[model samples]
Target: MHILLVEDDHKAARLLARGLEEEGFAVTVAHTAAEASSHAHAMWRFDMAILDWMLPAKDGVALCAEWRQAQHQLPVLMLTARDAVADRIVGLNTGADDYLTKPFAFDELLARIRALLRRAVRAQHGILQVADLTLDPATRAVNRAGERLDLTPKEYAILELLMRHTGAVVTRQQLAEHVWHADLIAIDNLMDVHLKNLRRKVDPAGLPTLITTVRGRGFLLAQPEGGDA
Candidate 1:
C-alpha cells in the first residue's frame, strides 16, 4: 500500500518511513503540511496518511479537516502526544479514522493500518463494470462479451484502476504510482508495453474500443457513443 507520512521531526519521520518500507509499504515522507498537501494533490494516489498532530503552521487536525471538507476520502491516522480523552475525541471528530499516541509500538501501528485498509476494502467491495467489461475485486476476475479474459497482474491492476474511474481520465503518473509503485519517468516505456498489450486483449476485433489515450493527458475507459455493447 502507498502511504503519505506527514511528520515534522526529521529523525522520527525517517525512522517511521524506513519501518513502513521494511513492512512492504511505499512511503512518502512529508516534513510539513505544505509538502503533504502537495503530495496529496499530486497525480500520485496515496491509500492512506499517517499525520503528526503537531505540525508547524497547520496542524494535522486542520489538514485532515481540510481534506474532509474537500471531499477527499483518504484515510488518516493521527499521531499525537496528547493522551487526554477529549483530545482523542477531537482527533476523531476532525476526520481521523484512527489515533496513535506518541511513543507508540510499531506493531500496533501496523495492525491499525491493516485494520483501516480492511475496512476500506470492505466499503468498496462490489463488482465493477464499464461497458461490456466486468471485474470482480473479490475474485480478481475479468470478463467481456461472455468470455473471461486472461490478464497479467500488471494488466489487471491497470484495468481495475481504469474501471473504477470509468468515463474519467487516469493519468500515467497515477497508474505508475498505484500499479508499479514507481515514478512515471522510470517506467514510461514499460507502461506503454503493458498498456498496448492490455488494449489488444480488452479491445479485440468487432467490438467498440473501450480504452482511449487522451494525448498529453492520460487514458480513458468509457462506453462508446450510443452505448452499444
Candidate 2:
C-alpha cells in the first residue's frame, strides 16, 4: 500500500501519485535520481518502487542496479518511452519486475502495482492464523480460541503486522509506515498507544505476552521471556 515514484516529470508524477493516493496508496515522489538515491541510502521503506527509465544523473536501470547491489530482492517497476521487446526484457532481467510504457493507463498501473506487491509478498502477504489466533488483513480481524477479540483498526493493524514479522524485531518506524494513516504519522504516541492497547487484547489472561516490547529498539512477537507455551 506504499510506493516510491521516481519520475523526472513533476506533472506526470503528481498525476500518477494523485490517482494512486485516491486508490488508498501512500506514495512518495522523487523527481530526480539524486532524490531517489538519497531515499534509498536513507533506507526509506517502500513496498514497491516505480522508476522512469529516462532520468538524469542515473537512469532507472542504473538506480535500480545500485539498489539491487545494496539490497537485492526489492520489487521495482520500470517506466519508459521505448516499447521494444528487447527493452522490456533488459529491464526485467536487470532487476525490475514489471514495465509500463509511456501513456499507460492508470488502471493498468494500479494492476501492475498490485501484481508486483503480490509477487513480492509471496507467502507472507495475507492474513495469518495460528492455533487459536486469527489475524485477517482485509477485515482486520483477530480472534483467540474462537473468541472474537475486539481491537480498533489501528490495534488490529499493528497486531497483524507483528504476526507477519513474527520472531523478528520490527522497528517502530516500520510499524508506523504500515499501520498508521498519514494524518497520524506525525502523532508522537502512535506506536505506544496502539501497542499498549493491543497487548491488553491479546494478553488479557496474563497467559503470556506474545507482543514483546524490546527496550529502545522496537518489538517482537513470541511468548514472553522467550519461553514455550
Candidate 3:
C-alpha cells in the first residue's frame, strides 16, 4: 500500500517513513501542508495518509477538512501531542479517521494503520448493483443478468466509476482521472477505445443498453425507461 506521511519533524518523519518502507509500504514524506496537498493531488495514488496536527503553517486538521471538502476519499490518521478528549473529537470531526497522540508506540501505530486499511477495504468492497449489472469490488468481478463479463483492468475501473454514479453523468475528465490517473486530453482516444469495448461486452445483443452518452458532457450508466437504477 502507498502512504503519504505529512510531518514537519524531519527526524521523526524519516524514522517513520523508514519503518513503513521496511514494512513493505511505499511512503511519501511531506514536511509541510502545501507539500502534502501537492502530493495528495498528484498522479500518484496513495491508500492512506498520516498527518501531524502541528505544522509550520496550516495544521493537519485544516488540511484534512480541505481534502474532505474536495471529495478526496483518502483515509487520514492524525498525529498530535494533544491527548485531551476535546482535541480528539475536533480531529475526528474535521475528517481524521483516527487520531494518535505523541510518544505513541511504533507497534501501536502500525496496528492502527493496518486497522484503518482493513476498514477501507471493507467499505470499498460493498457490492454495487445498477439494474441488472453487479460489481464485486472485492473480487473485481462484473456481471450482467447473472452472466459473468471478463474485463480489462481499465475497463473495470471505468465501469465501476459509472456504476457508482448511476443515473448521473460522469465526465470524461472524471473517468480519465480515476481510471488512468491522467488528464482526459492525454488519453481521450484511449478512453474511447476502452469505453467501446466495455459497451460491446456489457450491452450485448438483446440486452437493454445501460450506458448512455450525454453529448458534450460525458457518460451515464442508468437503467432502461421505467426502471430505476
Candidate 4:
C-alpha cells in the first residue's frame, strides 16, 4: 500500500516513513500541507494519509477538509499532541478516519493503521477484480482464469495498482511513485523491466494483451468488454 505522510517535523517524518516502509508500505513524506498537496496532485493514488494536526501553514484539519471537499475519500489518520475528547471530535468531524496523539507507542500507531486499512478493504469487498484476474489484498493472493499465480512483490504491487483502476490508463509516473516509490523519469527503463515481467506472468501465452501500453501514455488493464487498443 502507498501512504501519504504529512508531518512538519523532519525527524518524526523520517522515522515514521522508515518504519512504514519496513512494514511493507510505500510512503511519501511531505513536511508541509503545500508539499502534501503537490504530491496528491501527482499521478499517484495514496491508499491512506497520515497528517499532523500542527503544520507550518494550512494545518491538517484544513487539509483534511480540503480533501473531503474534493471528494478524495481515502482514509486519513490525524496525529497531534492534542488528546482531548473535543480535539478528537474535531478531527473526525473534519474528515479524519482516525486520530492518534503524540508520544504514543509506534506499535499502537501501526495497529491503528492496519485497522483502518482493513475497514477500507472490507468496504470494497476485500478483493479487486478485473475480467478474470483476481487479487485478494487480505490474502495476498492472485488468480487468473481460476489458476493461482505466483507473483513477486513488485509484480503484485503493479498489478494491484492496475487492477484498482481497471480500464483506466495508469501513467508510468503513477506506477513509479506507488509501486517503486522512485522518480519515474530517472527509472523509466526499470519500470519497463517490471512491467515486462508482469506481462509474462499475467499473459504468458499473450494473444490478447491483458495489460496494454497506451503508446506515449502508460498502461491499462483490460476491462470486461476488452480494453482500449
lDDT of 2 at 2: 73
Per-model lDDT: 0.90, 0.79, 0.89, 0.87
Which 10 successive residues of model 2 have the least lDDT summed? 179-188
Ranked by TM-score from best down, the candidates are: 4, 1, 2, 3
The candidate with the higher lDDT, 1 or 4, is 1
**Model 2's lDDT to the true fold?**
0.79
lDDT of 1 at 40: 49
Clash pairs of candidate 3?
none
| For model 1, the run of ten residues with the poorest summed lDDT | 38-47
lDDT of 2 by residue, 84-152 (tens): 999999898888888999889888998899888777666355768644577866555688767789888
lDDT tens digits, residue span 41-151, model 1: 552377889999999999999999988897888778999999999999999999999999989999999999998877776677588887788998767889988789999
lDDT of 4 by residue, 59-108 (tens): 99999999889888899999999999999999999999999999889999
TM of each candidate vs. truth? 0.85, 0.80, 0.67, 0.87
Show model 1 residue runs off by greater than 4 Å: 146-150, 204-208, 225-229
Q: What is the lDDT of residue 158 in candidate 1?
A: 95
